[model samples]
Target: MKKIKYVALLAIVFTILFVTKANAQTWNIGFPDTTKVKAILTGNKLVIEGKGAMKNYPRHKIWKDSVTSVYIKKGVTNIGHHAFYDCRELKTITIPDGVTSIGESAFKNCENLAAVIIPNSVTVIKRNAFERCTSLKAVSIPDNILEIEEYAFYECFSLENVLLGNGLNQIGDCAFRACHNLSSITIPKSTSTIGEIAFRECYNMQNFEVEKGNIKYSSVDGVLFNKKQDTLVAYPNGKEGKYKIPESAVVIGNSAFASSKINAVRIPKTIKTIEGDAFRYCHNLSKLKVPNSVEEIGILPFANCDSLERIKLGSGITEIGMYILSQNENLLKIKIAHKNLKFSSKKGILYNKSRDTLVMYPRGKKGSFMIPENVICIKKGAFEDCQGLTEIVIPENVTTIEAIAFQYDRNLKTVTNRSTTPQKISSEVFSYVNLKNISLFVPSDVVDKYRNTDVWKEFGQIKAIE
Candidate 1:
């Protein structure tokens, strides 16, 4: 009976001691003070943990200068703002599965971080999470991650590759700014919106390979490789000079050859569309031969070509761009395959040989000018600024004369036509300066044809002077 009594007494004392300790147990999260928690440096790394249940890892104010790698244990779900910010040497981090959200500036300016693996349970990664991590090379996002917030990977210089998550839908603005080493990148098909400046200044970015017909802009073999049927653009690496693209290529991208030195070019028969600045500022390009397959021409495609002297436009082309041959003063000839076609200019006129448009004279030649026998029409401004012209003759088969065919001309005194058919003449044929003293001399049988038409309206009466 005495032994039983002693055992019961000991049991009661132990139970009292256990209850007292449990009542005093208060939560202490990692913080500056021990009462709350302690973020102490154990050697090289900083360790943070919770002291009690309710005070589970308080959000912010962590990572002193000595911190290297942070470990968010099983209970950490919410990491406060700027928690591990600007820790330059923090190379690696492993967040336990229970951790969910990472706050803004959480891993900002961690320059030595090479790579990161986003956990599968993380739904959202807040703003500037990995901003300016210059040493980071690549990152792979988990399949469950839905959104990556603003500037997450902004200015990550060494980030060369990124594995997008399946669930990821969008990339925030300026997400990958100034990533110089990123030579190639592949964006996932599930992504819908890529924010502005997301891939800006990625100068070395050469190609983007995606699902068929998905990417709007891409590159192939150091050439602009777009799958959208936009255009096959080629850019010269060292200098531009005499490019011979196959006739089968189409479309030229904007600024593909901006500010280059190409002296001459031979465009093939396969080209269909020429975009803006297709050949701008090609300072030395003296001549261009456009094939018959082209239809439409864009502005400044050949602007400011100082040495350009001749261009042979294709037969099927309809609309001509403004200033297509601006500032090409040395140009004295243009050859086209169509006779009934029209061309405008400030000076030179279109000379027709059979169905082909022939030479354009800037300053009309003096002495004798012979029109090809099978010529059809003479277009506007063809001889506008030709002040030196004195004598001209129409060959046996000449027919049409457009507006200002001989405009802004002086010292022209005589014209002789051998054409059997009457020429369709406009009143402004010689209206600019001096057709008053000029006389119309026609074939004997064609006297009535010249008299009836406006060709000799401002000239002296036509005498059968053939």
Candidate 2:
């Protein structure tokens, strides 16, 4: 039975390939003449050779099981955008020295492509050029290239070796993201700029080397840092156990520790800023203490960390972004020091310094919750995804409830608002909730006001408080 299945699969593969070849018509990039760009199929190989530039290779599904190889001859100056995209069966490609640029997504998702020589004459590799080329094992970037664009080599799971050229100046964001088998990489001395998330999600890279005389970046214990060592750059996802931020480091670059395996981290007091998504998705991190020297905390810094339960904020943190600690299912408390001028908390719930704005309510806080009388505003996503609450009391002073303030509260059945005036709200304030089954209790004088309000009118029962 197994042999028969294998044979059937082979037959299906051949049938698809043959059908593609049957549909093969001469596709010329520009004006079709003897001197212009043209493609022709000879057996399983697609031969593309001409004196001028080819506008584009083909669409994603066009070459799925058909073409096995592509040979761009010496006179072709450019390989246009998405030329060989999603060519699953293509294994070998020969790009001649006359080609000057390989356009965006030129070889994207070519799963069977193993190796290719980019000629020294090529200068630009546009965005997503070799993204998801799973079987690609080795590539030597030519010396004349200047930049490697975003998602250029993203998610090449089996890619093991990459040779960067000395003349290359910039590596774009997420250029080599998630290349798990890549064990090491050497940054050439001439490369001055490496974009954010450039090496993130690379699980197996153990050593990051910066060639001596490189002035902009450096490496310590296989981690990348700025030349002055004040900014913490990329940390290998494969790195294990606890990590301590160096004493000299003041800034943690965005997405620096995202999706990492670290169980604990110690932030030194010298650190001043924790950028957006800096510690995002660190599954093993259970606790964190932001030092008193940190002045700003960016969005979603510790989000999606399933095990994180507690955090102690420094007194100096005056700028805190929205959803900074969102999606932490186990989070129960956030302790803020007294000197923080912009933020404060009541019983582990985050609020602005004056307690006038309810910032975030813990998702794990059980039973009923009450907003303080001083709170005039409920910020966006203040009660988002809080699965524990079944009832809530909005103080009389709260005149505003931001979008999605009570979203995803499946068990919430009652809401008592003391406000006399109809509170302003949008249509999506109670999204993903069964408002028709929930009751709204308002002040006696505001019963009609609550029942007639835009979003409040959808409540199943509206009553006047005694």
Candidate 3:
């Protein structure tokens, strides 16, 4: 009995040794011919050591799930691209002082990584370097860093504080997008270039503070603007109520007021240009008046404003972009000045000054609509999401209908086409409309032509317009 017990104990000891050996393994992830750098993993700790730049591992070479900590030795000069990507269990990282750069997506999707020490020796934080580090709470940009590339900290929901270094010269597009908890950001004086939508969708951001003597940028009332204060750069998403554009301002930057909570905005006559998505997603904005000084307006500048009810355009406008007034659930009218040479309005509907092309129809307009006698083309998304439209009359001169011209008009029950020959159009033009349940009316001589047409033939009833 004593001998058997001793044998069982020995068996247990050997099993423990085997499990330990299996859990503690090593991998040489360095390029011996080019650099002396090496990555060695033992148990849950990963150690990066030696000199020169480390090899870029787009995918994890070590057991990423098992690594809870990382210690980079002082001699390493760079952290290669995607070196520790998707290390879900990695909780801490200690970057040494000699590392000069953090490569693209080096630590992307490290969900459990709560803290990282980026040394001052680093100059560039490449695109997506620390993207989606959901648990990270704070970051301090080192003084030597020159640029923070696009999507570097995107969707880091728990990040609340950021300290920008004075040496930062540029911030790439969408660099901090969707960082919901970020409350405030200060732009350093050396930053000269800020890409479009760099701070978009930061819902809780309240203030944009610019350090004194920043020659390229400035801030007033927590709003960002160029140094001369002529161009509005960004509006904090957390602020509420009416805002009056300064008389000195001439241009509104791209996505300057996107996802903001302002109920109204007063534009001055000096403002000449409105960039794309300037006021998008401002659910509380109710009215807008474009002054005569404005010469150009970019695409979707005022799209998706749920409370927008009226827009007045002045005569000086010469250029307008597509879908500027799309998806406003409560918009009721677009009133353009009669002297305007490029566009016109009839019964609140927007059209080219010649009145030959229908540009936009308010989604809030209800009941049936009669196409004007001179209209020749229907623009794309002209009648999209107009849920109250029950019938439409197409004039004889109408020759073309663009894609999604009548999309999402779920309540439309009838369509009357006055042409003798069916106008060719794709089925996508009527997306979400129940073609089989609605009736199509055509001129008496074209009943057969309408029934034989590709997209028109799907109608439930084809009848002569007696």
Best by TM-score: 3
Task: Write one digit per residue (lDDT tens) for candidate 3, span 253-295.
Answer: 9999999888889899999999999999998899999998888
Q: Kindly report which residue pairs in candidate 2 clash with one another.
A: 57-83
> Could you tell me the TM-score of candidate 2?
0.89
What is the alpha-carbon lDDT of model 2 when measured against the actual structure?
0.87
Write down the TM-score for model 1.
Answer: 0.42
Q: Candidate 1 lDDT, tens digit per residue, 1-466?
A: 8999999999999888776655432334433443544344444465545542213232334444656776655555555557778788788877656556677777888898787766777877778888998999988887677777878888888888877776667777667656766666565656655554465455455555444334444445444445543465434422445666644467654444434465766776777777666766666777788777777777667666657766677676666533455445455555565632554222234443333443355342355576655556665555554566777887765566766767766777777877767676777767675556777787798788777776575576576764
User: Candidates ranked by lDDT, best first?
Assistant: 3, 2, 1
- Among all windows of ten consecutive residues in candidate 3, which has the lowest summed lDDT? 26-35
Q: What is the C-alpha RMSD of each candidate to the true structure, in Å?
A: 18.5, 6.8, 3.6
Give the Cα error of residue 242 in candidate 3, in Å: 1.2
What are the per-residue Cα lDDT tens digits for candidate 2 across 1-466? Answer: 9999999999999998998878665656642353488777666688777788877645653455688999888888888888888888889999998898888888888999999899999998999999999999888988899999999999999999999999999999999999988888999998999988888888887778899999999998888899999999978787879988899899998999998888899999999999989999898999999989998888889999889988889899876655888888778888888788888977898898988998888777788988889899999888888888899999889989999998888899899999889888997788999999999999988788887889999999999876
Each model's number of backbone clashes? 4, 1, 0
